[model samples]
Target: MSKTLHHGLLLLRVLSEQPQGLTVSELADAISVHRTVAHRLVRTLEAHELCRRDHQRRIVLGTGLVSLAEPVQQDLRTLARPILDELAESTRATAHLLVRDGAARMRALMVVEPRGALVHVSFRPGQTHSIEQGSGGVAVLAHGPHREGERPEVSEARAKGYAVTTGEVIPAVTGISAAVPARDRTATASIGISVFEYTDLGQLGTTVAAAARSLGRLLD
Candidate 1:
């Protein structure tokens, strides 16, 4: 396969395992390449915020994916901005909007940061995640979000209505995500929230579920 495709798939596989985002070195070994090569591959993914570097020099999931998924969400933000904003204001935490590009790629976002910690923002619009790397990505995958006409794990999630991704994508980051069925069969979309992995644990689950419901209403 071409290097671009190779790295892209590798990045995806890495995130699929869990939210414990991979390090350049770890990712390098997974694909049987040199660390330097893996580092470069990660950088490519980073351009889309599919991965991010952490204090330990490890790669973590990013919030840059929201913007890339604008179309998939069908302008969920545009239509639901008021509700989303109110939720953000009430939660005082970051809120995310995400969608999958059906085997093409996945995108996410951390649209509004809590007013108190806007400076401590975690994700920006247009951030993309390697479907292979984080709970954010895996949440979509676990829910059987399609890619290239394949629904990976949506059935399981459909039976469950929500997917909880932890330590699979980002080591210190966890994400909770839920999908909103779409009219288009070719692709599917979901909305989720991500935060540092070290918080009260359950908080990640609770907040994400609430945010997802808030967004789900927009689509309905």
Candidate 2:
């Protein structure tokens, strides 16, 4: 379409990645456009209600995007709930769906809660992280063989059905194995379960595999 429209959309994509909002400079740096061009683009987005500028002059996603995103997120959550619950029961531990951030993956949603008081792990709504060498991260990155950059081992993970992060991302946790049913289009998500290693690998593996398969069906 028009130059303004194209630049506005690109600016919106950059803003979408960050919840806090971005300065005009940050946006310019991220998309590698000139500062003036980025400012004009942001102003256009604001006019359309797709972006908003704070008092500090930072840009954030606006009402117009919520209008578009609400429907899609609603459907995804509805479809994923039952599968996440089933995975919780099967694994006898926490099961989660994680999305990538920058170069890492952080916990996004969970269907289970850790039981013990002293040895407890919980995820909050605003959790943010990287997509390093972890099971959940690797699975989402590798499952679709989405080797667009920086990860040659992602191929190994795809061929192996699931990825195992043996305390690479976390400490003392034996491992997490996860599967990404759909990474080609929906790149920021996967189905994964954590294990303490003292638990039964055979039964847990089967359970998680089934859960991943079920999730895969939905993604397909």
Candidate 3:
């Protein structure tokens, strides 16, 4: 690879690991590059909006990377179409697939939404939510990281192999979800469904968990 391209990639890899981002000197030390060279590379990235300095003056990833990654979510949605359809049809509820945008961010973005019934719930793809709130988020967190004192909901999810919630993300709607395990240690994705009401919780949870396992295997 060209020297400048190699340096740019090195900086990106290093920044990808640092949640709070990094300073030019710290980045240089991490990549074993000179401060001047690191500064130049960072400037190039900043000009393209691939990287930018945050309020703390630390180098951080910018929206350019998000644009580049947008297609990845589309691809995931396509790959998950059949499974999502099966889930939506089985439950007769709006089925959704959510994935984390980046490794360090705890934000989960809705990547797919498959309609179930004519009166089913409606949700928008590309919507983002806290990874600790809804069933979809908890599903990802059940397999992802947690604070020192983890939440009871997440613990329950891990034990049950699925997460269920009511009025969490959307008031008056119940959600059932299971995590789509990733090969790596990242939070991985989640598949879920939303409904106005569910009479049989156990059966719904079982079906969602089964769909999640099948999706996980396909992803694997």
Which candidate ranks first by lDDT, i.e. highest? 3
Question: Tens digit of lDDT per residue, candidate 1, span 36-103?
Answer: 87777788878878768878777766656545544755666676566556655655555666666435
Local distance difference test, each candidate: 0.59, 0.66, 0.81
Per-model TM-score, in order, reads 0.49, 0.67, 0.79
Stretches of candidate 2 above 4 Å error?
1-3, 14-37, 46-71, 101-105, 114-122, 144-155, 168-170, 183-186, 198-206
RMSD of each: 11.1, 4.8, 3.4
Q: Least accurate stretch of 10 residues (summed lDDT) in model 2?
A: 113-122
> Candidate 2 on 122-192: residue-level lDDT in tens?
45533545666667777677755455674655666677666666666557564455565563544566666
For TM-score, candidate 1 versus 2, the one ahead is 2
Local lDDT at 10 for model 1: 68
- Once all C-alphas are superposed, what RMSD does model 1 give against the true structure? 11.1
Candidate 1 — worst ten consecutive residues by lDDT sum?
180-189
Name the TM-score of candidate 2: 0.67
Q: Can you give the lDDT of residue 65 in candidate 1? A: 56
Q: Which model, 2 or 3, shows the larger lDDT?
A: 3
